[model samples]
Every structure is written in C-alpha cells, then in structure tokens.
Target: MALVAAAVTYLLVPLVRVFALRIGAAPEIRERDVHTVRTPRLGGLAMYAGMLAGLFVASRLEHIGAKLADPRVGDGQTVIALALAGGVIVLTGFLDDWWGMDALIKLGGQIAAAGLLVAFNVTLLWIPLPNGGTVSLDSTLRTIITILVVVVSINAVNFVDGLDGLAAGIVCIAALATFAWTIALTENLEQGRLSVTAAITAILIGMCLGFLPHNFHPAKIFMGDTGAMLIGLLLATSVVTVTGTVNYDIAHREINRFPVVLPILLPLAVMVLPLADLIMAVVRRTSYGKSPFAPDRGHLHHRLLQIGHSHRRTVLIMYAWTFLFAATVVGLSVGGVPLIVFPLVVLFALVVLMMMGLPLWRSGRGGRGSGGSHSARRGPAPGSGPTTEDPSVPGAAASPHAPATTG
Candidate 1:
C-alpha cells in the first residue's frame, strides 16, 4: 500500500517539473552559477507535493493507521512536526528562489525552523561515553546543536545541487543506507516503526528517482534553492524522527545505552556528502580569510570538474563515492562486518578518487602546479576555461564552458 502511494507520487514529480518550467521558475546561467542554459527551478514543489501525497496515503491506510495509532508508532507526531517545519522551510526557500534573500536571512529562517523542531523534542539529549557513562548536555547546548544540524544540512543540500542530479543522487544513496540501517536495527521493535521510516525513505527515494530523469546531465530543470532546501530539510527531519525520536529502546534495550550518540551517527551517515561538502567549503573559504558562506568555486564537485571531469562524469564520480559510503555503513550493521571494513572501503574510495584525479595530475593542475604529463597546452588558468563558472556570478555559460571539451 505504501509502495503504491510512493509509485503514484513518483510519477507525479516529472509533471511538476514540466509545470515548474512553464512558471518562469528557471535558473539562469550567471557568473557564479555553473550551468549554460536556463532551467526551471521549482522542482522541489513537485517533489514535496508528491511526498506529501504519499505520506497522506500512508497515514490513511487502514492497516498502517491501526499500527501507527499507538503513540510509539515511529513517533508519528515528530514526523508531523517535520512535515510542518519542512513546509515552512520550503516556502522560505521558494521565496528565495523567486526573490533572492540574503544569506543571513535565509540562515535565520533555517535556524528558527530548527528551533521549532527542538521545541517538539526532535533532538539529542545525551551521548554515550566510551568509558561507560553518558554525556548529558544542557538544554541550551542541545538547542544550539540541533539548530546547527538543521541549518547545516539545509545548506549542504543547497550547495551540492550545482550539477545535474548530483544532490538528489547523493541523497538517494544516503537515504538507502540509513533506511537499511533503521530497519535492521529496529526490525524486532514495534510494528509500524519500521514501516513509517521505510515509508518516508521510500517516498524520498521515489521522488529523487523520478526527478533524476529531468535533472541529469543536459538537465532541463534545476532544483534550485527551492528544491535543494526542501529536500535537505526533509532529509534532516527524517534523520531526527527515525534515529533520535523513535523509541527503539523500548523494544531493544541495547539501543538505549548509546542514545544520543547512536542517533547522531545515523544522521551523519544519512548526510555524509552534505556534511563533508559543508566542512570542505568552510575550510576552503576560511583558509582565504573569506566568510564561510561566501560563494566560491571550491565545492567538491567544482574541483572535480576543474580537473577535466565532464559534467556527467563528475556527477557519476560523486554517485560512486556516495554509494560506496552508504554500502560501508550498511555492511557494518547488516553484513556483521568488522571495523576493518571501514578502512577497506576508505582505501577503495581513495584509489578510485586518485584515478579520477589522474587527469588533473597529468595536466599538472592537481593542486600542485601546471606541470603534469597531459598534452602540453598552456590553457587558461585553473577555473578560467569555459567549463567552470561561478554559479553565483552573472554572465556565465549554461553548459560546460571549456577551451577544449574532454569527456
């Protein structure tokens, strides 16, 4: 039944994509923006509308509703809170999409929305210590942390939407991982707990799957801040509701031991790409004495393209990394794999990343010097070619802007 609802919503996203394009919600190629052609930007509305429809169906299903009626059924109220807060955040972002808002204002709205979640008890209160004690935080600290998580996750998704299907693909990978983990850990618990999380995860997966066709390389539409922010908010809220708010401990005593820390880990796994991107963005930004939120071409995806990766190739590389990470965590939990799996996966990813870096290495643009073994051509400076454009800057090309294209 839930699957049926997801399928229904999944089909609806493309139609919405078409509608977005017709409504003048398109992304223009700017100096700071990366793409070449103008693409519709309100892809999030279709996604959210479909997701809401799916959830509504799930909530109304007789069998599903009977199980969810219990207060402990996957913390339905928390999910509701998530949906409500997400609606607000989505609206905030849509407004930004239509009429640009300053970074501080957008951030302020994100923080406030997160604060609302904390009010609903969607938060982490205590962390399990390595030495057997629990680390309990004060309300203020908890609030601050929760707000940061919400805001950061929102922007992280926003940041990664630079390339076609990149953010959606990474998100789909992360959700699959976290969804698998949630089910594995809580399968023996209450009835609908798994179902609710599974339902929401399925909806997210479906929406992304449906949207990707239109969002991939040669994308006809962009998710923009509207889609990106909403998707991020939904992912963040799902993490909180499934990992933090769900009462898995009542059915499995061992889970309660770690409490806060375990929940944190789940969200971290679910948002690995965005979190990594956020940290990298901050490090790169601060290193040059610029505001952390300042727009720049230092994003992970940007660097990948700068090294001669094509748009499609760059998106695929990110997809591979995300899937690899997701598989690692799921393997740890379900395959009953040992800690060694972490190092093994990390090594494999690095090897692949190095191969991806070979082009840059050969071109002498791998962050060292323009002195590698690729065809000797004194091309424009790094990020100077037509391929790399500042998404935030105006007068940029929509497609790959490079001196000579190399797929």
Candidate 2:
C-alpha cells in the first residue's frame, strides 16, 4: 500500500502542477496572508489524484481484490461511500479554487456529503459509556454529529493553512496517530482492520510527503482551499470510519478489561489542535459580533508572530507543540500513568513556554544583541544614530532607502 501510494504521488505531482498552471490557479498574496509572493495553488489536484491512484492500485491488489469481491467484508459499501464523499468535497473545493465560493455554500456542501455517507449506512452506530453499558445514538443524532464533524474538520484545516506546511503538517501528524491507533486495534484483534486503515493512511502520508517540498516555507505552490478541503475530507472520513466501526459493546468491553480509553482518546488527541483552534476562533469572532468565518490575523500562528517570533520560528514552535501533544497521547496509551505522563507532559510544556517567552526576553534586551550578535553594528541604534553613517554595518552608510521599521 505504501509503495502504491508513493508511486501514485510520484506520477501525480507533475500532472497537478501542469493542471494548476493551465487553470491559472495561483494564490494572490494579500495583506492578511503571510506570503509576499504569489504561488500556484494546484496541490489539491495532486493530493486527490494521488489518493485515487493509490486506492485504485490497492483495490487491484490480489489480496484486497479478493476481500472486495467477498460480501463478507461488510459489502464494500464503506469504501465506495468514502470515495464518493471524498470526491464531492474535493470537487467543491476545486470549484471554489476556480471561482471563490462563500463559506456557507462550502459548508452546506460538506454537510450534504457527510449526509450522503450517513445515508449509505456509514453513521456512527454506538457510543461507549464511561462506566459500563453502551448507549446507541439515534440515526438522526448520528447524522447531525457526523455532519458536524465533517464541517468542523474541513474548516479547522482551512483555518490552519495560513502558514506554509502548517495545515499539511498538522493533518499528517493526526493521520499518523489515527493510523497507529487503528493498527494497534487490528493487531489486538488479530483481524483485517489494519489493511484498510494502513492503506488509507499511507496514501495521505505519501500525498503530504510528496507535496511538502513545494508547500514548505517560501512555498512554490500553495494548496489553497482545494488542497485544504481535500485533506480535510480525507481526515474526517478516516476518523469516522475508524471510530464508527467500533461497536459500543466492544469498546465498552475493552475499556472494562484494560485501558481502552486509548481508542476513544486517540482520534480526539490527534485532532485536538485543529478542534481547539476552531472553537477558540469561533468564540473570539462571535464575541466581536462578527461571523465566525470572518477572516483575521489572530490565529495561533499570528499570535506567535505578533509577539516577535520569526516566521520560521513560529512554524517550528507549532510543529514542536503538535508533536509533543501527540507524543503525550501515545505515551498515555502505552500504559504510562497519569502521575508520570502528566509530569512529563508538563515538563515538555514548560520547555515550550520558555521558548515562547524567549522573544519577550530578547525584546526586553533592546535588540542589543546581548549575546555577541555583531555588537549592534557599533552604532547608536537607529533613532539614536547621528546624522553621519554607522560605517560598521553593511548598507547603513548607503541608506538611500532604509526599510521602514514598525514599532
């Protein structure tokens, strides 16, 4: 499956680049946008093409083919539903990329796609109780919940795409966590669960891996709404399919027997960042009497930069935080204690806090290069400088157009 995904992505990259160029799908850098330059936004086509190619190849594999042929493996309905729903979301995003669509319309489409999945009998059937018994949610409630998940995940990813590689990186981390949880379950049960989950994850991983080179800092191409929505759909579908498959009783039994909170926690843990960001954004926007979808430069990344962190530093910090949280969740699942894991997580968080505080410390130092940072060009800093040039600094003497300094 991994090989298939890799191959598909390898072939699809150029195709997507060409398609994006042909469509003139380039992102125009705006005031609120981070990039200073325009970049092609064809990554969605690449990702979707990779997904289809990988799935198609995997489906043709003899072992998987046999399974699909058999009605015993739950009727192949889930796979079909996934493909159809993903296609819907991908097309909607693709269209939006071509002719920008309103948030409400996009959201309505997402809900409708999710509703289609529910109609195909792919709804969450059960909920494991905290204590013992299982509670089965009604179809209507399940549909609503499923639709909400799809919409939330789609928008959360869309919101997080401000920084190059940010959204892709987060989704990749979440996918890895979900893949691990699913594989663990399959191993625990000694069943066929791993194949589907692993295959799905491999395709996504390959797509991100293949695209990251072009999507990283100073990105040559932006995934734009198209890539973001495609990824969001994939992520949403993976979570629902994996979690929805867990029978309430089975989850309850596992919880009663051992520490099976891992299964329930895994998906939530993987998605915590995007979910939290979305919730916070909505709350913040609503408080100002603005629509939740209103655009702003107040995302987590923006805050990280607002206080003086460099762009690269801010992105790296977010990645580190994401990795640490994911690691903490994995550690807990691996039988680490609340006593141990909590402390370790806290310790890790403290390190991040210190890193986050470093900018303030630096600012307090007056940009003086306190630790041998070229001795501030041996001049009275900026405003304090004399009419004569600070000959020591490069270009300070030739200041025909000194860059304007923001307070």
Candidate 3:
C-alpha cells in the first residue's frame, strides 16, 4: 500500500505543478519564505490522490478487507470520515494557496471539518488511566477535545512549513513512528488488528516521501498550506483512532508502570517538536502584545539559521531532535524504562551539541591562518553563507536586491 501510494504521488506531482501554474496557484515570495523564486503549490492534490489510491488498495486486500467489512467496529466509517475531513482541509488550503484567506476564516473551516469528524464518531471518547483502567469522556467533552486536537495539529504543521521540505519531513518522521507503534500495539493488545491508524500512517509516510523530492531545499515546488493542513488532519485522526479507541486492558496486562501511559504519551512524543514550536510561538506573540496569528522569523528553524548553521544543517538538526524524541518514547514504551535508554539519550544529546557547535568550531580554526582554509578561500559553499535579510520581515536588509535565504 505504501509503495503504491508513493508511486502514485510521484507520478502525479509534475501534472499537479502544471495545473497549479495554469490556475495561478503559485505563491509570491514572502517575507517568511525561504525560497527566492515563485513556485507552484497545489501539490497537496497529488498527496490526496495518493492517499485515496492507498485506501482503495487496502479495501481490496483480504485481511484488510475483513477489518473494513466489520461495521460493528466502525473502522470503515472512520476511514470515510478521515477522507471527508481531509477533503475539506485540502479545499480550504487550495483556496488559501491561490488567494490568501483571512486567518479567522481558515479557523472556521478547520472547526467545521473537525466537527464533521466528530459527527462520524471519530473522536477521543476515552483516555487510558495510569492505574489499571480507563476514564470515559462525556460526549460534550469528547467533542471539545477532538476539535482542539484537530485544530491545533492543523496549525502546528502549518506553522512549521516555513522552510522547504521541513513540514513534510517532520510529519513523515512522525507518521513512521506512529505506524511502528501502532503495529506493535496490534501485536500485543487483545482485539487489535491491522487498523485504520496504521493504514493511514503508512499512506501518509508514502505521500511525504514521494513529495520530498520536489519540495526539498532548492525545491522545484512547494506543498504550501494545502499539503501541510491535509497531513495534519490525517495525523490527528490517526491519534484519535489509536489513543481513544484501543482497549487498554491488554496494555495493563502486558506492561506495568509508565508503559501504561504510552497510549496518551505516544502522540505527544511523536509531535513534540512542532507542538513545542506552536506553544512557544503563541506565548511569544502574546507577550509582545501581538496577535497570535501574526507571522515572524522567531521559529526554531529560523533561529537555527540565524545562529550560523547552514540551511541543510538546520533542517538536519531538527530531524535529529525529532528522531531522538520519537525514538526515546517508543523505546521506553517497548522496553519499559530500561536503564540503557538514559545512555542512548545522553549520546544523542552530545551529538546534537556537537552539531550545533560545528560551524563555530570551524570558523575559529580557520581564523588561526592568515589565508583561511581551502574551502573558505574558495568562498562559502551554496547555502553556507550568512543571509543579510531576515526572510520573515519584508525589506529588513539594506539592499532591495539581496538574495533570499534558502533552507
């Protein structure tokens, strides 16, 4: 299913690019943008098509078909809800990509789509207790929580899309981790099987992977709001399906202590990077007496570039941190707080610290020589020099013709 989805997305992207061009869906270079050139951005259409193809394939498989056929469990209904909700976001995003919409209007669309999911019974109705049972949420509370998760997730991904390939790569890492964890649960927990969560995550991974080739640094195209919000909705839906619907009794029997909270913790851990960025953005904006929806270059990735890390290096650093967090959570869940996890964490921290300091170290070393190192003498490599302009603030640099920052 993943391969099929990848192939479909890969084949469709060029076609989508042309369609975006014809429809005037190309985005102007913005202050918050990393790319200098205007790029077509309805690439989410390809991703959505890939997802549909994957679902179609899954529905025809023997084992997966059996699960879909079981109406009592409502897996089929959840899949339909996900598709419908995804369509809403994709349409909303496409509109915004072509002709920017008001922030409040976008928020309204997100709420309506989230409400649609709740209507289809795709909601977090219950949560696992650290003790030996579960706590059920009242319908109103469930609806509220579900809507919050969906909206927050959509915005989280949207906020992180400041750089080429950043949002898609981060979400792909998240979906891969979630897919692995979901597969583990199916194996260990009673009444668990190949689930909608796993299927959707697999498809999500494929879509991101397929899209990355065109969307990476020095990108030929951008996913824009369309792809980011669509994937966010899918991710939130997967979290709700797994965390809210799973029977925790089996988890209680198979594991003890902290592992019992894995269901709740897993989603947060997978998404910790973006969620943390989102929280910090809100607090920072509010503290400055600005609207929370106001755009700025204070994002973690932006800061990384400002601190002398090259664009590719900054993206890699974010990827490393995300992997460390997701892997640690999964390791703890599967291994039950083993001592080795600490050493692994320490090792990762050292690696990150070293990465963060590398440019400074090299600069200091090169300064010792009058002529500078060979690479320095040859001029900074592509995307290795400091950017004079702040990409998030229009006309921040002295020169109007300065090159745009790339990441």
Q: Give the whole-model CA lDDT for all candidates, comma-separated.
A: 0.60, 0.60, 0.69
Q: Candidate 1 on 1-407: residue-level lDDT in tens?
A: 33553465457657766776676555444554433456566667767776776667667877655444435432446457656776777787677665557777777778777877787766655555534355566879777876777777777777677667788888878777767766766653444455555666767777677677767766666666666776677677666555443554363354433322344555565455656766876776577675665555555676665556666777899888778766766656554444345546556766776686775666565442643222112212222212333344221222221100000
Greater-lDDT candidate between 2 and 3:
3
User: Which of the numbered candidates is closest to the native, going by highest TM-score?
Assistant: 3
Q: Which stretches of candidate 1 lie over 4 Å from their true place?
A: 1-23, 27-35, 66-76, 125-142, 188-192, 243-262, 337-352, 363-407
**Candidate 3's residue-wise lDDT over 1-407, tens digit each?**
88988889989999999999899887555553334566687788999998888878877888765665554334457667767888898888888777777787788778988998888877886777655577789989889998998898888787777666778888888888888877776776655554767877888999999998987776667786788888888888778776544656666777664555655666676666667777887787578776666665566665555445656666778787777777777766666674335446656654774577567556653332334334333322232212234344322221111111111
Worst 10 residues of 3 by lDDT: 398-407
| Alpha-carbon lDDT of model 2 | 0.60
Cα RMSD, each candidate: 6.1, 9.2, 5.8
Ranked candidates (lDDT, high to low) = 3, 1, 2
What is the overall TM-score of model 1 with all chains considered together?
0.78
Work out the TM-score per prediction. Answer: 0.78, 0.78, 0.83
